[model samples]
Target: MGKILVIADQKDSAIATGRGLELAARLGYSVDVYAFVYAPLGRLKQTAAERNALKQRLLEDREAEVQARIDKLSREGQKVKLKVVWQKDVAPWVVGHCGKTAYEMVVKTGRRSESIANTSTDWQLLRECPAPVLIVAKKKWRRTQPVMAALDLSSRIAAKKQLNATILSQAIALAEAMDEQLHIICAVEVPTLLEDLDLIDSRSYVAEAKQAMAPHIKALARQFDLPLKAFVVKRGPVEKVITSQAASMRAQMVVMGTVGRKGVRAKLIGNTAERVLGQLKTDVLALKP
Candidate 1:
């Protein structure tokens, strides 16, 4: 029911619209995308006539992409609506808009370029965006590639607890739409404060954490109408456990929550979700709690 800000990367337009429109349809959210294009300084330094020619070329290119997308949607008989604003400096506007209006989530087509100095927008969004960010990879999802939803049962905030439910619900919707497997996982680690205590038993502690998580997991299962086996609680560093499980599951994407990078817990080691993003090759859907 809320707004969804989709920042299209324009890597593969068909793939972008396919993933974007699919998600919008699933959530029934009005899609507003800043269909961004990066023009190097050199390109803009040309003479007026040359720059006009370049502008024409860019316009034609964009029109072709839009037409192709329209054809695809027509063939598929999908009426998913999208409003696109062509923008150059993208990430700043996206972050700024989040403060202006509450966006439920942010969607994008591809990952940022590896070089931060050159292409840092998407990376910055991952760390700073107030809403959830869904970065869709180029490779279309396959039915066998599970959609992994990383759950943290230990977070006590009412907001975060509700966010876990939202993450799982969105993941379920994605899995159902794509007819893919849904893999739910939770990782447990001994609290650092408890290190001084002589009572630390990693296995027993992990077992108890899993036991404590059981009722919550079961409740999620009942709520989602999913089987208990779809959920798993494991022992390890949360980031490491998530990436490993996703790799083992051959996950196409991982859905997890964040509290932004400005929170106190985010200062010491950065958000675990960001670390997990670094380790994963699969697509990531980062939700905000």
Candidate 2:
């Protein structure tokens, strides 16, 4: 596996750096922190000297946080590095940098608020990040338990499948590294309209989905040579199915992909992958294609 790149916000909560460092230590992977500094509003309208001072201060603050996090990781036997980047569009810049770097995974903290109106930096990072990204929220990080990889069988997007496979691969690798179990779950959504029409014979659909997923799951299991379990759920909404299953299985982390759809297309039709990210309490590893 390549190095893990953490795109950290200098102004947001320090949880981003803390989570990244913790994961790096647990997984035995080196960490490269890209600390981003947004241009100050006053500096945007200030004199050259004043703007320069503001920029210097921002850099200094960011550097201090980065160094502190790096030291913490070092105490845990992790090799850590820091890079300070001054960019207005930190999301795209981080994505482009990850594309060029030898990084297999990217970690960042989740948006502060879940309300739709309150769009945080982590939300933007989730939407645009290229690598398989982990959004750490305010909770105890589960490091030594099974990681859940949630698979949505409804969407037939090719990119989504590829991204899901990437997440599964990462989870399996992490589980192996940590000597933990890995669970692969495909959440099957039974349409309410079908239920209303008394056509909700979900067994066939569940069986078919399980059959289709069998080869992939077996191949992964064989590749990893680890204990793997697969589950096909045929009830409730995608988010509920995933969360309930993960909770039942006592999973430490949930890994899945983000389907890049928006507006009415995202709402009326909806994307289970995105909804699962929003609803789940487990640490999520969301991949963007």
Candidate 3:
């Protein structure tokens, strides 16, 4: 297959890079590790020549550091490439780079402290990156834990329906490669106005929702050969249900979809999946359509 792009954060957690290496080894894909470093000019109170010299020194130092880290993670028979760049805005740079190059996936570590809004680099990458983005958490995967795929089954839109398929396929591939089980989860959200107007009981609404989704779930089962025990249907806010199910099941990763667009709609994952990411402690594989 194609190569995987591993973005190394300034913090150098190694979690993202290490995960990328592991996936590359398993999937037989080459890896391109990019370490970003930037030095603010305002912070340096020196002559122009001195500032330039110091900046060059900083770049050399960071390159050496990142090289050493990659050398430690290197393995025999693995095709790995490394690049060190002085880019302050990593997300946009990556988006531009990926637009030019083809990669199977973009792997990066996520910050749990980011807000639910689409403001962080991770959120931007999820919305704009051409390739699938895998946001890794600090927690390591356990052998028995499964990879969860969260689907928006209620959406009648064709794009969303196709996105559900994409999410499932990616999750299945990852689960198989990792030798882990695959679990499917879908949340049915009831309109608040129905409850406010007393038009329908919450239980009734949820029951109806599940009934409507049964055929789609069955179709998925037939297409993917998923067992009944592998499915989980819950009624609640999408983000809450996903986070709860992932935690309860001790999932190693939660695969979900994000709509890649511009303007207001670009905030697709921010509305639901972004919230889930904010609360979830497990790794996430975000697909785009």
Candidate 4:
């Protein structure tokens, strides 16, 4: 199996690393822990060489500290590697590394901001990282909890269709590996503006939306060999419905896809994955189409 890349933060608690190690141990994959560290800037009068020396010392210290923690937390007989890079921001480095390395997945702790307008490192990685990114939460996985896969069945776009398949495929693999149940979640988005203007009836619109999503949902369940009872179709905002269902079901993780929006488009439209992630208390496995 390929290695799983776990991004370590400067925080005392290595939540991502621990979760990644557990996942790796379960899936039989090795782990590569990358700890990005930075030293305080030297005084303006300080020589360049002195500043460089300080940075190197800081990197070495962080390396040792991370290594000790990894040694303590890593599973026995697991092939885990550690690399401490002297960089404060990790998104760029991790995105570049994923391009060069054949990691099965990239695991990182979700650093969410209060507002979706403000982007976090997880948002950056979700957009640019080539490999599948798993943003773990504070809550650990429970064996009985289901692994929920979110799909946009209303979208007829080829990319969305492909992404739905990818999301289900990953979720199925995870559920099987962890011996957990697999659940499917799709939100029926009713147009609020049209309904408000009396252009469309709210109840009829909801019925039509659910009806439109039926065949696709059935095909997916058959394709994945999942029972119909495991599927959840709800009406509301995508973010609200997914988060609510995950909470209600006590999902271990929610697997979904992001189109990898960038720049102004990302900020303006606000990626669904980003918004849902802001509210999710469970782990998320985000894939790119």
Top candidate (TM-score)? 4
Query: Which parts of model 3 are misplaced by more than 4 Å?
Result: 42-53, 115-118, 139-144, 260-269
Error of 2 at 127 (Å): 3.1
RMSD of each: 4.1, 3.5, 2.7, 2.2
Candidate that beats the other on TM-score, 2 or 3, i.e. the better one:
3
lDDT of 3 at 248: 85
User: How many residue pairs clash in all the candidates, one count each?
Assistant: 0, 0, 0, 0
**TM-score for each predicted model, relative to the true structure:** 0.76, 0.80, 0.90, 0.92
Candidate 1 runs further than 4 Å off: 1-5, 11-14, 25-33, 38-60, 73-77, 80-86, 98-104, 112-119, 139-144, 191-199, 263-268
Q: What residue runs in model 4 are displaced by over 4 Å at the alpha carbon?
A: 40-49, 114-118, 139-144
Superior by TM-score: candidate 1 or candidate 2 = 2
Prediction 2 TM-score vs. true: 0.80
Model 1 reaches what TM-score against the true structure?
A: 0.76
lDDT winner, 1 or 4: 4
lDDT of each: 0.73, 0.69, 0.84, 0.86
Pitting candidate 1 against candidate 4, the one with the higher TM-score is 4
Cα displacement (angstroms), candidate 1, residue 192, comes to 7.4
Expressed as tens digits, the lDDT of each residue in 1-289 for candidate 1 is 7667766446455555556666666666656654554465355667878876776677667656665664564325444344344457777788888878887678776653543235356566777888778776665435438888998898778898899899999899878866788999988977756755756876778788888888988988999899999888887789989989988877987999876765344545577766776677677899876
Comparison by TM-score, 2 against 4, better one: 4
